[model samples]
Target: MTYPPQHAYPASRTPGGRCPVAPSLYGPEPDGNALPAFYEELRREYGPVAPVTVAPGVSAWLVIGHREVLHLTREEADFSHDPRRWSLLREGRVLPESPIMPLVGWRPALLYADGQQHRRMRAAVSEAIARIDGHELRRSVCATAEELIASFAARGEADLVAHYAQKLPSQVIIRLLGLDERTGQQLIWAITGTVAANADSVNASRRMGGILSELVAEKRAHPGDDLTSTLLGHPARLTDEEVLHNLAVMFLAGNHTTVNWISATLRVLLSDPAFRSSLAGGHLTVDDALDLVLWRHPPTQHFPARYATRDLVLGGRPIRAGDMLLLGLAGANQDPAILPPDGAPVVGNRSHLAFGAGPHACPAQDPARLITRTAVDTLHHRLPDLRLSVPESQLTWLRSPWSKGLESLPVRFGPRR
Candidate 1:
């Protein structure tokens, strides 16, 4: 699953052009960290499938049931990923300039492709990611994490979210892609701007495209042992434009989700004493902590619109042709069908819908796991006393409809002597 680009919140409306009476899931809450509660409420009130407004004049079903999400995602023939099939966008109600376009907009990337084309693109991406050496990547991630933490270790205090969590993933991905430091820096800025989806988003999108195009050309002329070059040499024989778009997909999707995953893992490590003590007492491992976060506070709360290719009923709700279905990933993980009521998160359960399911499941989960675990492990090793500087309640989550990214993670620890 991918994140919806950050955008301004407009007024709310449901389908059929009527004033929205259903719960709206696209705006900020009075409590910045109330996403869990909100998901629970939706599930309790609507019985797993609830009518919700994604944007003004945009109505969709938020599928909060675990079984339903699995069925919908696996049956790609019935529920396709191609946004071109969305009825709202087709009827001129959802305009090109709409803020949600960055999410549901048609792209030539793997995220939007379907059927045979999706298989081809997915194979290319999966193969490219598979070729990377896991041990080498882990070592690179650990080293990057060490450098990031050392940069702030002497200060005794820092926003780990900004200084460490966000930077480590980008640097690791850049190294994997075999890009230079300057270009890597530029990619970071361009990606930030593009996902922000503000006045600069259009320019940021163009800038990112230009950067990817240049990298593709460079790799074509002088191939190297990197992801871009690997894609260029793949048997898929993807065109230059295809290479650029797929690279964009990998970079953009990989960085955003990994950043949030890192931040969320750190939040749990710092805020929950029992959880920290579990690690200290040897009752749990970092991998267990990671799994808990995946099940409880997933990096991506809700995935973007998946259009229904035909009329069908899911979770007792009738879905029409071309109707939008937003996968309630965090909600589904909390479903009683999977996790017993009042049950704690299972230590090694990897069945959560956090990375998605079926043919379109995220292809880079292994790399993401390595980066997150190494980052968290390195941080604790560097500063064992690290703790939150501010009260946990004072910390806020970024108010976006897609991912549960922390706004900042202010932390303090014993300064290095």
Candidate 2:
């Protein structure tokens, strides 16, 4: 099948025609390669609030403008992150009444929850993440980064995505969660495979979920002072199943997003010599690097899907209770009204929606930022000559619309001193 060029828009969006609104928008099959490009053009044509079909029988109001997305994110009354709501709207059946709900018995976590439950989960996780001594975590992360760089620097070559970007975050997260090396690797593989943009990777995710379920049971019987244990200890508030669900979410969310940021950031750095020089000169701190990375290329291109719980008006469009809403985080980030011109590269001290907004925002933002900052800083110091081994066009882009990331990134650099 031929994919559209990077800038082509869908023909139906043009004048005097009704766009196909059903399966084209909401069907389970992966969206066409032209979708992102189409969305870009629609943003130009329809402004921030555009009508799009996300799945079959599931229409959504796409929020493309930065300010509007921010408003929707913070306005819990208008937008609901509850998967049950979305599933009900898409399937035309209430979630709890569905067979899957009974079999899986999914519970909403901070990412998918709102109100007091979300607040409590965020508060608990935030307290733990914030209390982590940055300096100490940085030291450990730096050591890991340095070791990784040393392994590849001598060859003057590396798959930056695999050798450094992917490795560092998983290692740091495993250490932070106090998981054994074997289990940590298993978790990483499961999360990565399950969430891959490729449809072929779905089976891997299923297998990983099975393993995680078993691991959750083990943790219950023999708990330790890790994040898992902390979650389990709060049984009054969270059920055992809820604890497992949250852990699975955390593992998948934390691992891949950080990995994507690092890979994309390195690609950006290699392409922009001035940025690389600035980083090497110590003009850019870890926080600065993270901000730039996030602003330029957020890991998740689309916001977590949300459903309208009640009739509402967004961007002057009437949104029914069952309609799906695809909050375009990437599109929002680039919205000219909310951000500076697209040509300007991100520098220091800017906030973007890479971690999202409001109650459903990623709870692990602090730790993620810390891990990314440490990896970038450590690499810049240790591998001053690091550069991509392959041409940019040769690098593979993951095809899924859910996340923006590279499949692999090969690089060449001078040997470690």
Candidate 3:
């Protein structure tokens, strides 16, 4: 999982120049969690378009400027979202020869596909998200948040990550998908393991895929009103395998990313006493907290890997076809060019790359935002004194290139009034 050193591009440097893009600021020494520092370094060295080699043969134009990244994202034809190319690079396989090729052989999930295929899948799922009544869902989320907060509130100690923040979104996603209680719990565990970016995560993804395959079969025989059943009823429209793929994708995409958001938001809120007071007073709404979370600590620290389908020019550099493009979302969000010149402190409502953009933008963003806002609002209102139990230095950030989140967050607070 280590990439070789490569140079990042500056607007003025030729590809064959002596100017070296800085070394990757992560990996073995830092255990791959040095993204924040890396971003800062790149910003200092290359300005808006610094070139850094993330891995061998994976030299990407790290678009740090907000407008630049947005422009690249909008140009789907120029920068493809195909995961196979990146998968090949990761496995060190030559073009079209990766063992995981079969996995990505078909057009990737809606997030990775292009043209009509991507549009059709997104359209199908859009209805489900649009049909969801956010107000009702928010009420349910608040009720769940209260119940969870109350459970540990009496104990005066809890791991916010494991017991509260992580659980809230899983439960919400389960309800949204209309899964049964037992199935929901299993899916939550499976999805969490799958997204953690470890051997366990890989195994969990496969197991979840198998389980989804079986569920697809069962749904076909006995259709219901659930999302799974809806996919089943559309047999001619979507094959069983495609349904399973989308469902598996949904589980991984929806569960972990949202969990990270919840944890990071809580971390930021608890770390700042003033912000906590503002939250307690209702001066800052859940929406406010969410905006702050995205700006301050995006769920995923790095952008998902992208590939160039052909030779193209970006940020004043020529990138060849099949070149791996690492769109540094975290880097883009923090770019000074996008934010106000005075550099206003991180707060909610700042436009960011947390959910990505363009044809492949996350479709579940609305529901995810609604769920997060509701959860935060509920917790603040129900447990005003909730605060961290452990010192900030003792906390451990999850070590993964895929998501930026904590391994745990212990908190204690007075019992609900």
Candidate 4:
């Protein structure tokens, strides 16, 4: 965002020629694991449209082609995101705690809606989020990052995940929604569980919903300049439940995505020496690093659940009615057909589907980038000599394709310079 783009074109169009066919066999269960290695394995074994299990006994097409994902994301009439439209969910196949269920399941939020309903819900969310001015957001993020950094700067070493990365976004969200400390902490836990989609996720989701409902009610009773009050006062006149669910969507998606964005960006800065040196030497802007991370790591590995409205053929693969399609955001970014002839992505080629495209594209990307870049710049400025305490190989990531999240980012740094 702070740097010029490599090129811009209508991402609505498909790449030249036909899609290369590969075996449509099911490779493995998705299990919501967001690993670069797994995405590479899927790309190598199965071409553009490959089959994979989102949960045990639930297989769907993972759209790995860049053009294919854009097409499906753009074709709302053909591909529905509603989980209730999903045949497997109706058949009771997805367990309550299934890792992918929380995302795939229907909620009255903009993320799962389509057509007029989606537009109506999105108006309020977009309007409310748009009120977040960039300058003020940067100020908040910088202050939060500085406060967080000061706590650990004297220690000479700290887990950025525990101290800065995770908490920064949570604190930002708290400020955005204007929630108290106790409620914000509870909300963060609930969001973590819902995104995790494992056992206890269902309960966690309900708790998050309850928290959102309370926040909405409080905002309704007494207004403020925060997002909660903005939504409540919006002309959309959304129902209490609608407002609650929408807020939950914001919390779930915003915090969850930002935490990973921050963590992965920090990981890249701390782990990749050459890349870090480029920034240190002024060859790369912070936005450049963030853009690369967005393409390669993305916020989520597998963008979940778009059900087929009718039978259709995609990338030479048979798609049946009610079949779900998971867009491989990470995989699609590497889709060779859409890449340069060298099979490598040129820097600043945002043609990647990191924020997705079409009607459901992320509405809050600018805010996300601002928060991430501010956090990154603040950290690097305070801890110029920051370096990873462990090798990249030894670091463990949270097994979540829903969010490509790092579990921890431990690092050692010289005292503030």
Model 4 residue 14 lDDT score: 16
For 53-90, candidate 1 gives per-residue lDDT tens digits of 76666788888889888987888878888888988878
Against the true structure, what is every candidate's RMSD?
A: 5.0, 6.6, 5.1, 6.9
Q: After superposition, how far is residue 48 of candidate 1 from its true place, in Å?
A: 1.3
What TM-score do all the candidates reach, one by one?
Answer: 0.93, 0.82, 0.84, 0.90
Candidate 2 achieves a global lDDT of: 0.66
lDDT of 2 at 322: 54
Q: Pick the candidate with the highest TM-score.
A: 1
Indicate the TM-score of model 3: 0.84
lDDT of 3 by residue, 191-261 (tens): 77655544465566667777777777877888866777765554237777777777777767777778888
Tell me which of candidates 1 and 2 scores higher on TM-score.
Answer: 1
Q: In angstroms, how far off is 49's CA in candidate 2?
A: 2.8
- Ranked candidates (TM-score, high to low): 1, 4, 3, 2
Better model by lDDT: candidate 3 vs candidate 4: 4
lDDT per residue (tens digit) for residues 211-328 in model 4: 8888888889999989989988889998888888888888888888888898888888777788898888878777888888887778777788798888666765656778778888
lDDT by residue (tens digit), candidate 2, 26-54: 22333323445655776766666677653
Cα lDDT over the full model 1: 0.81
